[model samples]
Target: MVVLRMTKKLPWLLVFMFGTVTASEFRSPSVAEKGPLRYVFDADKPGSDSSLTMWTAYTSKSANKAFINHGTSVSELTKLFFNESEFRLARAFPNCLVEQAGELYSPLLRTTKFKTRAKYTECSCIMGARWSCPVFEDKGRFVIRATVPLRRVEIERTDQSGVRGGAELQDVLTVQPVAKPSTDTGVTAKQSVAIRADFAEALQQSNHKNPALDFTGKIKVGGHEICTFGSEDTADQNQTDATKCLAVVGVDEGLIPHVPSVTSNVAVVSDKKASGSSYSAVPAAGGGGSGLSYFSDTSGTYANLAEDASKTVADRKTDQDTKARMWLIPFRGNDATQIEGVDTGGTMDNLRILSEQVTENPREWLADRGYKFETTSDVGLGDIDIDVGYEHLLNEKMKAEGYIGVRAPTGRGDEYWSNPYQVRRGNGQHWEARFGGTFAWQPFTWLTAKGDMYYSFALEHTEKRCAAFTGADIKNMGPQVDANVDWQYLVVRLDCNLFHPETQSLSSVFGYELLWKRKDNITFSVANMQTWLGKKYNSTTNAFATDEYALDADVAEKYTNSVGHKVRFETSLRATDYCEMFIGGSYTFAGKNLPREQDIHAGINLTY
Candidate 1:
């Protein structure tokens, strides 16, 4: 929602006065000191022409375009002044609803009625910007009177030079309080509170037999009233056999808040499970045979037999059954962040197949099959690639996960080719399978330590061009480890990446990161990170070189190093319930051999 506040141009103040005075008292010579001429009316005095005078008039021209100036004219004066007497009359009486030539001109009366003389002693004056007027008051009366400045007419004028001028005529309007009808005050007898309960067995038995309506009338004990409200139904579960009942107990006015009554009903069912089976059993692994041999025999025979036999017989007998059931209860406050309930039937079969094959070819296997995957790629490939990973958890603490992902070229190249090469696309498909576990140790209430480990194997297959350049099928096996310690408002974390490169020869590379967080009324975090380090045997040069040994290593080595220290700081101010302002900066300090670069970023964050 957006809120726009109108600008105020004038500082108008109000003073209120209350007194008993007749019409003649207002017209007396001594009262003239209040300024301007005064007029009063008792029941709309006959033949009275209370037309006001002694006021300066100015013409205003209004522009028809422009939203801010839509209602007022440009020629209108920025400020207006009303004499004390004129202001008083405008404040004390209802605005005149004058009609001329069948045209109605009312001073925008705010309310429908005017107050009696005895109650009309207080008055207030208001002055403000267009549409938003200010209110000034005389505080002597029991009730207050508010006056508004109203626009009467709009005009537009174009000068000789073709410049446009607009104006509007405004008048002061008065508002008064009116009386309303009194409410009826009829006494009511006191009622009583009722209580009832149905045990589990009773509820079960009621399902077998229909019970009729049962109620307990109001009863009083020791000046306290009680009423029991209930009902019971006995019939077949059908529209014709259904029953609905309700009861209400009226209580005395004084006891209304203290005593309350209740009504309830019970329904009986002729057929316990009228809708048929309430529970169903789905075999996690569906095939004709049983035991692990069923899958082993099929897989082995398929691989050994002819291609036709494998496709016709082995494929037909493979278990590919996947089904899910959801149970809904009409209750609030259920944990929906993750799926709950145990896999009570048995250990699902072919889980490893899902972890391997599905993760390996996710797009072809799970695409359009209701599974979601996400991934990040190419920290080293000079592009960003994201893939969805199929994930599931086991035993609450252990997580089984896998993903089938593809990384294509980005930018101008992305539009024409899938990968880096123009002649041959660099479309790389990668499959990752990993198992992770979390452990927590709480030595004290204010301090705790936690750790996690993930060991994964990634099989990456790129197009022929990429295979020729990389000299391998592009498969990598890696283990990731992360641990953290928290002491109330302070937290420290460590993460490491260790992987064996997937190339012609086995090579190892490792990266590490450390982060620290401190929290008070606000939050702050700092992190130091580095990555991609390894020693490689340069066959062409017949010498040992680091992973940074590119063909243009000499140029890069002149001013910058391959490895650098990345430092980042993030800070946020907790402004309110739903908003926060955060600022963060990162600097990359090149190794003793490289040039330096830094980056800065900040933005507001809102949570609903």
Candidate 2:
């Protein structure tokens, strides 16, 4: 029995000497050669193929606060209304200019019903009628209060007396006319006419009284008139009343006028309709010209309606900064009642989100509509880990170990349709138990030095999470519970190794871990049941609390507590006497709330 052969010396232990090779093993050895006691198996390689570009998150511990790449938060957009002045919306229905005929006792047709103020130079469409009126420049003026939908026609009257309220049977009623733009009207004429002026009654209603004309000049575009009404002013030569002298000439120089300017025409003969002409226009007014032409005289199609009203008053003063409008409804209130939680009755009518106006920075307009942060990933079988340790050498240069494990629960969980930086493959279905210890030494002939510790426990079970409510709640938004989660953790490592001599089969270890997690006592395993918008009403158990959101304590203070600190590096090789292969990567540079992640792995261990 005098036979022993050795090779493949130490790549984290797998030494088996059998027959031949001897020369006293080339002497110079003493206590440093048998510290692996065997029984380690690994496998790995189901997920990560490493090529990441951007994705990081750490809830808090301040590395300048990481939520890295594609982050967004202004409390997730939904606020909906604040008004620090100037936010006049209006336009749910007014602006009918005509269409309502039935009862006419003529108190002026009983005060004719429909006219909230009409005056135009350009919301065009004459013979074929289609008038819209949208001109907004509020605050610095030029406000055309919109809501127009005109174009209904009918006319005729012979009258017959009836119903004891004077000749009343003329019936037909629906006249929506505001026409003038000939050439068989296909209507495409607009040369500035944004009315809403009161320059002290526009020079006492000018019809060109011309005392040397000068309703304060400006009003050109095609027919040249920086202040016309002169050349002996022929019947008030027309630039259609320069929209009431541009409301007293304020659109400086960049004159704005070309034609079609009726500026208010309220005329009524009602039994239902008949208006061959009507008048009450003041600026540049003077029309009895038979059949809709309140004012006309062209050669203008706006070369500068004051540079489009100074670019709409600098885009309405940059969209008036923030009249403050919000409606961020992640559902739960205003009837979806979680006791009216998302800022009192939220309702964007189901978030079709058509800009109820945030103007800018509503998280950059919801990150240009894609709403940012979504870089998912996933792969199979992950939370397995099944240790059964028991190594014990204690000399040849030290060694010791002890293990007990379970882990199972096959991985992957919490996938309410992903997106929350998606990337799940395990640990969420948690089932752990673990319990560890390691100690290695091998003081030299090629280094070694280890120390490890572990603890997991976690058992609870019920699963299906996602409902943080607020803590920068990364939008998983409401509903999805089962609870009873336990999550406790604690790890610790410290290693170094670097062999490679006569097939120490290439080594290299290097490590440093220290994880720590505990804060996810999440309960609701049955507490008050759970309904979320239906049964609610638990004024501290005053009756009605089958649970409409009551796992309480602000959701157990939103489960926090985290800590990390990885930094590993591997590189093994052995390849034969019981196999061994490895590949490395780890790097959670620091800790807190966790997920700094920097993966990359590759494995195979098998050393029974």
Candidate 3:
């Protein structure tokens, strides 16, 4: 048996040695020497499948164009092509084995045949072929083998033009894998638990980290689904639906990290009463709250009048039965009792002249009463005089006072004037005397009234020439009255001159103002005026004449016969607490044919 085995292997060993010797002697052909080769697939073969079953061809003409085909078998036709041919190994044959004959050349020769066990289960077939076989008389036939992956084999073929060319093959063979099977029950359970834990942690973190996240999906816990409330519509639906119960978790600032605690608490208390409070404890008068008193006497103590009266009576009675005493007593008395029963007897003949001189030059007479005198520089023709007088207080409101001064024109005395009748060249001088008493009364808190009345005589003297050039110099005696009323936002005032003209003619003016305050810093006021001239004057006649007389005159062109109407508007702005600015304008419409005139004034006042 050893000898037979060795003998059988001898032929195979000779074949292999001969093949190696030939291969060593042969040289591969150069690529330029080999010609072109092509493989042609028989796509029409019935039930026969090849490994090159689904072949696709692409052309360089256009990207979108291609060709496809599925074949049952393929054959290489190298003899019909040019010389120096080369063949690239394409896909292998299915369900078949391939081998090359001795020393395969450039245009190689190969053969394939299907296995005996390879069966065409459906419309597929296995075939064999041979090439350059030693047993065959001519070139051998080539073969291809294939089997279907599933029940039926379907093949596709494409050409260079992307045109598909194939026929369906029904016969197929199915194969199954020989690996182990798998089960996912444990994996699915683990995945469910992991997902639930992740969702719960995400919810808890989002409540504190990011409060804006909306978690409204249904969560399954313990096999029960709980729906979360998100929107009004979802809440309403949950309320109406019996199968779903909404679960809500509200997030507040307290749930967030690092929120500070409140520092204080608010409480409500009722029926709390102050202790030891009485009506007298409040205040006797205007004691508390503003710290001002209503009945408190802010003016000092009252004076003793009885002592002053006795002193004055004794001083006057010491003078003898002289004519000067007679005049002085009546002038100093209150009424006419002493003046009517004056005894003009005794050594009083020269006394009358002396008294008359003293009355004429009242400065010397006032000097005897402890008054002082001073003079100022000449102001044009007249000198300004200042007399500060204080009286001995005899009562709370009355006093005995006297003044001594003269404000005469500069060139009026005997030295500067050649003739006293000659006119003064400048303004006139005035001689004035003043006497008054002040009284005040306050009947209630926040109410006070004070008044003062004084009799004054002002004598103005001017030479006839100066008077003609600079109006007139007449004596004007008058009493001026002023009253002020203050009531919060409303303020009123009255000022009148009882004797305005030397003829005792009275010219009075009364004005009432209404204020409308729109803001704390702005105020507006309107005022009405009722003014009348007691007597009318005519400019046409150049004398005191009525308007009717001036209108009837032959030359009435220079006269104005009508009264004027004036309207004013004022506005003020408080820029600061101590500074204010105001603008006011007035318009006056005069007689017929006269234009409406206007006057505007603006000013700013600052107080420190």
**How many pairs of residues collide in each model?**
35, 8, 28
Candidate 3 has what TM-score? 0.14
Report how far off residue 261 is in candidate 1 (Å): 99
Model 2 agreement with the true structure over 338-452: per-residue lDDT tens digits: 1111211112121111111112332232234232223333323334343455444555566666766565554443454222233334446657786777777777757777786
Which scores higher on TM-score, 1 or 3? Answer: 1
Highest lDDT: which candidate?
Answer: 2
Against the unseen true structure, what C-alpha lDDT does each candidate score?
Answer: 0.19, 0.30, 0.19
C-alpha RMSD by candidate, in order: 43.1, 31.4, 72.0
Runs in model 3 lying further than 4 Å from the true structure: 1-385, 391-427, 442-445, 459-462, 466-608
User: At residue 304, what lDDT does model 3 achieve?
Assistant: 16
lDDT over C-alpha atoms for residue 285 of model 2: 29
Model 2 vs. true fold: TM: 0.22
The alpha-carbon root-mean-square deviation between model 1 and the true structure, to one decimal in Å, is 43.1
Per-residue lDDT of 351 in model 3: 21
Give candidate 2's error at residue 92 in angstroms: 30
